[model samples]
Target: MEHKIKVAVNGYGVIGKRVADAVEAQEDMELVGVSDVTADYRVASAVAKGIPVYASTDEARQQMRAAGYPLVGGLSDLLGKVDVVVDCTPAGIGAANVDLYRSLGVKSVFQGGEKHSLTGHSFVAHANYKSTLGRDTTRVVSCNTTATVRTLTALQDAELLSKARGVLVRRATDPWESDHSGIMNTVVPEGRIPSHQGPDAQSVVPNLDVVTMAAKGAHTQNHLHFWTVELTRAAEAEEVLAALKAMPRIAFVKRSDGVVAVNSTVELMQDLGRPRGDMYEVAIWEDILTVQGNELFWTYTIDNQAIVTPENIDAIRALAGTVEDGAESIRRTDRALGVRADFTATD
Candidate 1:
């Protein structure tokens, strides 16, 4: 209803950092400020951008000031100024902050790390964008769930997909955490089928028929998802690529170009001059796409850290009715943030 939604990002870590940047890029929203407990280069970066950085506690304010980050104000300053808060904190922190957000009479968005019951609306703008419309508090589905739901939603929108199964090769930690976050000496399995991702997707797409298993890989850069999405009818590989290509948030990798690994994909995005070195699309390897009867099988790398950034942006728009259509909001976010980051190489 207001001309622009004032948004504060509560955590400045991986997800929070990307969300802040994405929110700043949006034409219809304002980044009121960002809050973080950790005092590091990230906080320093925010200060350098002239973005107000807030500390939630006296100890945190002291730590940030000690680290030479100029403190504009404390957490209450951000909470008081903003219309809505995107709690980009670690897994459980957002859940804890719900009461605080409410006390301030602010709308909020949480990340997928929180339980679905954390809020009435669990959001994937491309999937359940309408569900979040006119809602106050919601959680942008996680990176993995976004990747899966984006694809599944596209297929379902076309009335093509009948069922789906995925084997998620998840990175143990994000790229920044790779130093301290232990690498998998060997692949670690979740030791169970029907990983939470399946249910997470279902939470957004009620009719999505998906089952997933997960394993942790040694590196922490991208998450590779191998999905077998069965369509209602047979289709060619080219048709599959076209279907995926037609989807807004999907970037079809036209060629392998000797780029076969997830790390190399990150390098490619970097070399292509991706903003913040972020890869916000599902980079589907089109050359490897296959079709057998009514099933389409493909592998795509989801930049686990950055792919969900735009979803948060769109979720914000949905909450504000800034864009009435979910697809339009997704398009605006993709265009602003450069989803897929580059398309000159695609055929």
Candidate 2:
């Protein structure tokens, strides 16, 4: 029998809950428990689902028990029981928890919010999965950086890419926080050249030559990116599309099919019955992809909430040394999560 890797999710917010669920879905992984600092409705939802919940602080333990939510123990208690801890806490908080995880002799995984230097390893399953095997810790690059690496690495693997530039239209905030936070009726630029995403992606695919600029849109839903790439040689649109299609998790949608914008993809995910309407794949507009000699232009949408969930699952397998081949690990994750390479049906 294959050993199921013991896992703990530290943080139960947007990314944390999703990563916890993904871990539970895998046949070769076991979700030991989840730890969070709050006793909010999110924690309640985890309890309702019968997921073991642990408080991260003494105060949180009191607050959770006071609020009638059961607790297993403090964060350290949970960490001691698991082999690896996926720290989904807010950006800086994950960095703060590193010492505790190390003190307990537990492997850890962090989200993109932390610097790559924190773990000295940034992971994108398709790009650098094997490199992370049996490592103590690694940070899964942010959703934008994940998508950037996935797409550009596809081109590079096909031996077609030279360099790339991109513009990201980011959602002002997460959908859940729309009422309390986020900008209204305003589109804000990122205020710098080569937004952090470019360098972040480079951290995973060290040889990638890419630069990015970003702006925050008024609405909160998904992020859209437009890219212009210098290919190694002139390629036809069909060739470029084939390269993208060859990559797993890169799904194609077409304007001709009425999939015209980011909203259309969101609606499509809901119609397809995805949990929380999550589109894990990067949805590229197949009809709009253009090729002019050595230059290629294309666009895609990123589901910030869900895209990295699978990568986190793969990272768990990598860190636990349960899976040796990166491709096999990715295949296992895609199967467990029902990740589809093609969203449309054909005769």
Candidate 3:
């Protein structure tokens, strides 16, 4: 029998709670502790779930007091208790903590953000599962990046496109407690947030270079992205649609009799019925793809935590040699979740 790998999650907000829950659900991973500099309902919720709550630092204590959490020591103490630390703090903080986690000899995973890049390698689970071998740190691409890569990898493998260009129109989540949801009636640019999706996915599937544009909005929920691509060959739009529609994690739904719009994709996520506050329930729609015109358009959602945690767990499993490859680890995880992926079956 294999001993379960102990795991700790620092920062118990939206992504942190989800990571902790994901760890608890895995049979090979155990949740050791939950830490936060500024505790709030999330920390209290973790306490309700029977997870240990540590004493925060003085600065953190004051924030916790305001947030209604009984503060704990600074983040350093969370270092010694687990093998992998998933840092879901604000962007700048995670990069700063990377050294601290390394000093403690613990493997860690990072979500994509501007200020930090703690990973030695990145794991897409589908495209680069093999990359996680013996890596001490890993980075899960951003939600937008995840969606784009999945599409780009599929299209490239089918030899449909040689180069890709896309535009992302993203939705902001409800602010930390703002009455006005982020996107009440607004559409904004993602503005140079460097989505490494295009280049990163190109590394695995081969034969494609990608460029992207991003737009952000005030809405606090999921996003609706539009991807316009220039295909290598002029194929029928239906054929291109057929190719994308065939993907497992991706679904192609029609919004109207002949029009593909962002709202159409939003409805798909609505049909998925994922937890209300969960970020992983994004659904995509291939609304407009003009093969004859050498262009394709689509929209999708992103469950940010879903993209990160599984890859992180798989990375640790790869390190432990519990699986021979990333595909096998992903397959094991799918089975655990009552899911089955034909695209990733091992021989």
Each model's lDDT? 0.84, 0.93, 0.62
Query: Which has the greatest TM-score?
Result: 2
Candidate 1, which ten residues in sequence have the lowest lDDT sum? 338-347
Ordering by lDDT: 2, 1, 3
How many clashes show up per model? 0, 0, 22
lDDT of 1 by residue, 25-102 (tens): 888899989988877777888889898899987988999889888788888888999888889888987898998888
Model 2 ranges with Cα > 4 A deviation: none
For model 1, the local distance difference test gives: 0.84
Model 3, TM vs. native = 0.79
Across 131-224, the per-residue lDDT of candidate 2 in tens digits comes to: 9987899999999999999999999999999999999999999988888999988899999998999999999998999999999998788999
Give me the displacement of residue 63 in model 3, in angstroms.
Answer: 7.5
Q: For residues 1-347, could you state the per-residue lDDT of candidate 3 as single tens digits?
A: 67887877777776677678777777887888878765656677776778866644576667766766544445667668777888777776788778888899988877666322356565566677676667777776666676777777667757786677776666566346456445556667654644555555554344557877777665554556666677777777777766665543554444444325444433433444433333232345445434556666555555544545555566667655557666667766544543322212231
Q: Per-candidate RMSD vs. true structure?
A: 1.9, 1.1, 4.8
Give the C-alpha lDDT of model 2.
Answer: 0.93
> Which model is ahead, 2 or 3, in terms of TM-score?
2
Backbone clash pairs for candidate 1 read none
